[model samples]
Target: MYVCPEGHMAYKKARSLQKNSIKNEKLIFFFDVEKCKCCPLEGICHKIGTKSKTYTLTIKSNLHQEQLDFENSDAFREKSRMRYRIEQKNSELKNRYGLKKSMSNGLFGMTIQSASTVFIANMRKIIREIEKKGA
Candidate 1:
């Protein structure tokens, strides 16, 4: 769930080395930065005046394959489920609060519009619960 600044992502191919370690069960993670520099979207990630982008990830945990598979098997599916809720909220904000057509210009105005939409959505959910109780 992390966005790399350098736009490069590397998955290590050193599984054998990690297996030879003391634990003999390890998750070897590699971070290769050079690959990112040569990417197609390098311009967007590496712009002038911007600090050097770095994509660093480390994972050296020792766990059995079955254990790791059990833990991470449904991770991608869970992320997809979470995305649906976020997208629904964004659509609601655009349709109900006019987020697509800003009422005022500038970054500050846009911030307020987004904030208010979130607040309104939460309030509406709470009010519905209260009304159900009263009825």
Candidate 2:
């Protein structure tokens, strides 16, 4: 079972459970993003256009009403800190690698360009790691 960031239900068993006779994986959905656009609690429980838009969810384990505690939880805050890193990496790839704007015109050319960009990025990361180690 994989916990989606949107707190949506997901139930894909691991390879070890392939031979098992289990029918349903029973994935639970939990989250506090009920004020966001996709949330059903928006406009009813909370006011519109709030500055502190807190979007969070948990699906691996069931927390019931305890999910509210995550609002002020240290672990949650730390996890949210990773949002910037992810956004930064996405922007870097999109800008430097031209991920969204492919130079290739056809399918084959696009595939080659994508592969080459990934390879180049990986190589750069490896070189940076080696340089760091030497330093």
Candidate 3:
């Protein structure tokens, strides 16, 4: 979609590697210099002494905006209220349970360790709640 100020259409020149980005490449485009070397719009598009016109198209991250309606909504507030308690529980699991590092190898071992840790934590919570109600 790149066009020079003189209404000349740009064509694909090369696929240039972006130094910082791993997944994206730059599509370099060039305008026909024969039609633009002496173009009156030279200063507007490029420097007046430049030989040819070239540009790269990059989609800015701002173009992919998040849903603003979901940010300050009721559901958002509800989750925000639970975030602290959930994070505290995760910290407890990591410190008290051997969740900071896997005690064994492979997916099966990790699953067993996680299941046991969560089961014990939930059981303790249920016992505490029952004792509180009984008191």
Candidate 4:
């Protein structure tokens, strides 16, 4: 079971199907049209008279749905808070360490530049830790 991003209850999983020359079959999930009709936020939730009553999600494998389900669990919610700290680190690298734009042209030069930037960032973190410890 998957809930929509807007918190709508999507209760059923439809079968997988491949329509054309697509390589992978798509996994579909659905919400009852009757529920949508009765919902107070119907206009905001879904457009009235839409042809389809289902929400379609494409999955790479059976494990993909399982992964999504795990992500929705309470334990995952607790762990996901750390993602914001990681994002802040990335933002610092881009803004403070000048990783937002490549200084060198060509793939090899870009690789070198990125490596150097990351090394410098790591060194800065080490220096800060040492300073904090006063040793």
Candidate 5:
């Protein structure tokens, strides 16, 4: 059983396997859309007179499900603190190192600029550590 984006109950219509070169087996879940048409929130959830209403969800195999479970676990919340720190670092880089505005054009130039900015940020961190130790 799967719920629609608008909280409408949708029954499972079909399930199939999708082959990919990445070695990850993808499972496709097809949900019926017939119930969606009669939903009270149909005006908000979907446009009127829309045809072929169906929802499909593509998920990976056991490993991906494990990952999903972990993401919802309390351990993942603690791990996500690191993500907040990383986001702060990114914000600092963008604000202080002119990363928000590109200094060069094209993909290669952008890569060089990003690498240099990160290198400078790391160097600054190292310098701050050294200064603290010296003090």
Candidate 6:
């Protein structure tokens, strides 16, 4: 939530959430700009003639600002990109390959079930790659 300079409680226009890093994070909140038109502090809040007015509030504590700064670095984006790809594969395993539940009851049964499920999934991927290469 945000408050205008004139003391009006602002309504959100949009919100963005970041993956938390050692901090309780509410990444960004965009205040509704339409309400700004009639606001007494409109001129102070934004330029006199612009159609768009945006105000953002980020809820991470100052103590974690260093972590936020690191998230903006190139290394973080690269790591996030790699994580996204693997997460997709993990999702496919659970959803399409039935890796979400064990087919058998005991530990050995669970292990073999898991191994065979992964093996089948890998074989399908290998076949697809070979097909693509041959084509």
TM-score of 1: 0.42
Query: Candidate 2: which stretches are off by over 4 Å?
Result: 1-87
Question: Please, what are the lDDT tens digits per residue for candidate 4 over residues 18-49?
Answer: 66644556667788777777777777767898
RMSD of every prediction: 16.2, 16.3, 8.2, 8.2, 7.8, 9.7
Q: Which residue runs does candidate 6 get wrong by more than 4 Å?
A: 1-39, 42-63, 104-113, 130-135
> Could you tell me which residue pairs clash in candidate 4?
none
Clashing residue pairs in candidate 1 (N, C-alpha, C atoms within 3 angstroms): none
Model 3 Cα displacement at 117 (Å)? 0.4
By summed lDDT, the worst window of 10 consecutive residues in model 6 runs over 21-30
Number of the top lDDT candidate: 4
- For candidate 5, lDDT tens digit of each residue in 26-52? 333344457667777776766677765
Instruction: Tell me the whole-model lDDT of each prediction, alpha carbons only.
Output: 0.64, 0.61, 0.78, 0.80, 0.76, 0.77
The sequence of per-residue lDDT tens digits that candidate 6 reaches over residues 1-135 is 666677666555565545755545443435556777778887888877787656765566776778889999999999998998899988988999998988889999988988888899999999999999999
Query: Total clashing residue pairs per candidate?
Result: 0, 0, 0, 0, 0, 0
**Which candidate model has the greater TM-score, 2 or 3?**
3
Question: Residue 81 deviation, candidate 6, in Å?
Answer: 2.3
Tens-place lDDT digits, model 3, residues 1-135: 577756778865777676776444567788776777667876777776667678987533432324456665899899989999999999999998768999999999999999999999899999999999999
Instruction: Find the candidate with the highest TM-score and give its number.
Output: 3
lDDT for 131 in candidate 3 is 100
Query: In model 6, what are the clashing residue pairs, if there are any?
Result: none
Residue-wise C-alpha lDDT for candidate 2, range 1-135, written one tens digit per residue: 444444443333322222464332343333234325566656753357764332233333245437658867999899888989989877877788788787868999888888888788889999999999999
Question: Lowest summed-lDDT stretch of 10 residues in model 1?
Answer: 48-57
